[model samples]
Target: MSDERRLDVLRAIVQDYVSTSEPVGSKALLERHHLGVSAATVRNDMAALEDEGLIAAPHTSAGRIPTDAGYRLFVDKLSQIKPLTRAERSAIETFLSQSVDLDDVVTRTVRLLSSLTGQVAVMQYPSLNAATVRHVELVSLAADRLMLVVILSTGQVEQRILELGSPTHLDDEAAVAQLRSRVNELSVGRRRAEAAVALVAAVAELEAPPGDAQGQSRAAVLRAVAGVLAEQREDRVVLAGTANLARSSNDFPLTLSPVLQALEEHVVLLRLLASMDGESRESVAVRIGAENPISDLASTSVVTASYTAGGVAGLGVLGPTRMNYPSTMAAVRAVARYVTEILNQ
Candidate 1:
C-alpha cells in the first residue's frame, strides 16, 4: 500500500483509540473504515506503521495504540481543525458579551473554554504594555497624603498613594488639577522606556520656583509614580478547567496530576508558551506527548497560538494531549481573532 494509505490507517487507529479509549486492532480498523482493504492487508499496514514507531501494540494479546509520535503525525499531517458549530459560536459570544469587568471576562473565559473542550484552560490576561492609560486622578486623603488612581483601557485600575515629607498646604482643587495635568503629560500610551523618560521630564518641568514644602510633596508623588510603573514586568496568568481533567481517559495519577502540577507553575507555563515562538500569527502549533521536556507535561499535549492587540501579542490556552485537536485549535484561533477585535474596539 502507499504511504498515504498507511497514514490513513494510522489516523483511523488514533481516532478509534481517542474515542473508545481502547487499543485498536487491524480487524476493527478494516471493519469501521472503508479503506478498501481486507483485514490481512490492514494488519500488514499496521505492522509497517508499527515498524515506523507511529503505533504500537500494548501486549502480545492486546491491540494497538498510537504513540506520541503517532499523535504528532496525526495532528501535523492528518487532522483538519473542526470549526465551531453555530450553537457553540453563539454560546461563546453570549458568555463573553455579558462580562462587565476584567475579572468577570477572564473568569468567564476560563469556564467557557473548559466547558467547550473538557480540558484544563489557561488564559494570560492582557499585558500592561498593550494598554493605554484611560484616565488618572489624584485624591487627597490627609494633610500630606495623596492617592493616584490609574485606569487603563484593559479595564484594570491601579492605585499609588504618596505620603509627603511635610504638608504643602495648597488648595486641594489646584493641587489636583496640577497633578492631573502632570500625569497626563508624562505617562500615557508609551510603554515603559518612553513612559519613564516622559515622567522624569514632567517632574523636572514642575519642580523649580516652588516652595520647599510643595517640592517635598511633589517629590513624594514622583516617587510613587516610579514605584507603580516599576512593576510593569508583572504579567497575569488565569487558569480554569482543571476539574475537567478528571473526565479524561488517561490514567489519573500517571497522566493527569503531573500535567496539572506543571500548569500550576507560572515559570513552567511561560516556558511552554515560549517554546511555540514564531512571527506568523496564523499558524497553530501542536506540541504532543513527550515533545515537551517537562516530564509531568509529557502525557499532556498543548495547542497554542498568539493573539494581538495594539501591536502586542499574548498567548491563549494550554489544552490536553487527547484534546479534540480539530475543534480546540479552531476554538483557539477563533477566540484569538475575536479577542484581538475586542481589544482594538
Candidate 2:
C-alpha cells in the first residue's frame, strides 16, 4: 500500500474509534470516509497497519483499534490542532477576567478547562521564588509587635507577625518609617532569593551601638522578612473535574480506583506536571498511554502547556487515551494563553 493511503486509513480508524469507542472495520471506514479506494485495498491497508503494530484486534473482533504507538503518531505527525471557536474564546476571557485574586483565577481556570474538555484539569500555582517583590508594608500592632505584608509581582500577598523580645523604638513613627523605607529599597523589584540576600546584607549593616534598641529592632525585623521570603519556595497544584473520570469509567479497562488514588496524591500530580513543562507557551506536550511515568496513568493521556504569570507554571487535562486530540490540544493552548495574559496584566 502507498504510504499516504496507508496513513489515511489509519487516521480514519483512529477518528472512528475515538468517536464511537468501538473497533473499526474496513466496511465502517469505507462507509464513513471517502477513501476513494476499493474494499480490497482498504483491507490490505488494515492488514499492513496491524502487521506494523499500529492497530490491534481487541478480543476476537474483526475490527481494529489504534494502539498507543498509533495514537502518538497521530498526534505528533498527523493531527492538526483545531482552533477554538469564537464562543470559546469569549467564554474564556469573560470567565477569567472576573477573577479577583490568585486563588480565584486558579479555581476558575480549572473549572473552565474541565468544562471545555470534559476531563480532569490540573494547574500549578505561580512560583513565588520566581516573582519579584512589588511592595512591603510594616504595620505597628504594638510597641514591640509589627505585621509584615509582602506583595509579589504575581498578586500574591503573604503576611507575617513578629514579636520583639523587649519594648523597642518601633513605636516611634519616624524610626518605623525609616526602617520600612530601607527594607523596601533593598528588596523591592527583586526575586525571592535576590530579595532575601539583599535583606540579609541590610541586616548585617545595621549592627547597633550598646543601647541602640531602635537599630536592634530594625535588624530583627529585616531578618524576619528575609526568612519569610526564603521559606515560600514550595509549589501548589489545584484540580477539578474528577467526577468526569467516573463518567468515562468504561474507558479504563481496569477499575477506576487506581486512577482516583493517583489523583488524590498531589505530590504525584505535581511531579508529573513539573516533568511535563513545555518549551514555551505555544508548545503543548502530550503524553499518550504507557508514555506517562505513573503506572496508574499508563492507560491515560495528559495534555499540558506552560504559562507565565510572573513565573512559569503548568496547566493541562487528563483523560482516557481515546480523547479527541485536536480539540483538547486547542482548548489547553487557548486557556493557557488567556491565563498568561490575565496574569501579566
Give the number of the best model, judged by lDDT: 2
Colliding residue pairs in candidate 1: 82-326, 301-321
**lDDT of each residue in 1-345, candidate 2, tens digit only:** 898888899899999999999999999999999999999999999999999989999979779999998898788884567789899899899999999988999999999999999999999999888999999999888987888998898888888887776665788778888888998999899998899899998887797996888888888888888888887577889999999998889889889888889999988998998889853355899999999999999989999999987788999999999999999999999999999999888
Cα miss at 228, model 2 (Å)?
Answer: 1.3
> How big is the positional error of residue 152 in model 1, measured in Å on the Cα after superposition?
2.9
Q: What does candidate 1's lDDT look like per residue over 1-345, in tens digits?
A: 798999899889888887887789887887888999888889899989899999987778448988888888888784467778888777777777787766777787777776666777766676776566666777887787777787776766777776665674544788768876777767777654455566766666556565565665675676667566656555676788777777774533355667777877977876666567462256777778778767788778777667664344445555555556777778776666656555546
The lDDT values for all models are 0.71, 0.89
The TM-score of candidate 1 is 0.88
> Candidate 1 — which residues are off by over 4 angstroms?
78-80, 129-132, 168-175, 210-220, 249-257, 277-280, 309-320
TM-score for each predicted model, relative to the true structure: 0.88, 0.95
Q: Write down the RMSD of candidate 2 (Cα, Å).
A: 1.6
